[model samples]
Target: MRIHLTSVFVDDQDKALSFYTDVLGFVKKTEVPLGEDRWLTVVSPEEPEGTELLLEPSGHPAVKPYKEALVDDGIPATSFAVDDVRAEFDRLRERGVRFTQEPLEMGPVTTAVLDDTCGNLIQIAQSA
Candidate 1:
């Protein structure tokens, strides 16, 4: 089988939408209200019909500590593929995105980690 959707726990949906869309360049795919929270999701503009990334709320009891531990350890919550890791890194940095790890090459792959601004570290990767 194949993946259809995945999620990143966010402190605020609106801010996450802005960062994921305006900065990271993903486009909104779906948004449905669910009481106090919405089922918000985004997809890469280049792959509109592909996998969707959900911006889930961090209101659950275990969310905060889990997210905190990931951040404290410098681990990324999710990774997105890019055509050029360095170029994407530079572009994101210009838009005020703080990166925890600069682009580093490992064999045929390159990756960089950046804070999502909504309590998660996200990575951008490229493969040769």
Candidate 2:
């Protein structure tokens, strides 16, 4: 079976949506009310009908600790493959994105990490 959805915890849904869409260029797929918070999801522009990335609320007890652990370890909550790591990094930076790690050669890939401005670091990578 194919994976249909994945989640990434975010401190604020609105901010996360803005960053993911306006800055990173993903398109919103769904936004449904779920009790106090909403179930928000986005998809890549290049793959509109592909798997969704859920922007889960960070305050949820089940995910709080896991999110914290990932941030503490400097591990990105999610990664997006790019055509050119350096160009994407530069473009993102020009759009006011803050990066935690600069582009670096990593064996078979060139990668960089940036703060999503919501709660977690997101990685951008390209084949080396």
Question: What's the count of clashing pairs in each model shown?
Answer: 0, 0
Local accuracy by lDDT, each model: 0.97, 0.92
Question: Per-residue lDDT tens digits of candidate 1, residues 1-128?
Answer: 99999999999999999999999999999999999999999999999999999999999999999999999999999999999999999999999999999999999999999999999999899999
Weakest lDDT window of 10 consecutive positions for candidate 1 = 74-83
Instruction: Give lDDT: candidate 1, residue 126.
Output: 98
Model 1, global lDDT: 0.97
lDDT of 2 by residue, 14-83 (tens): 9999999999999999999988889999999999999999998888587778877888999998888999
Each model's TM-score? 0.98, 0.93
C-alpha lDDT of candidate 2 relative to the true structure: 0.92
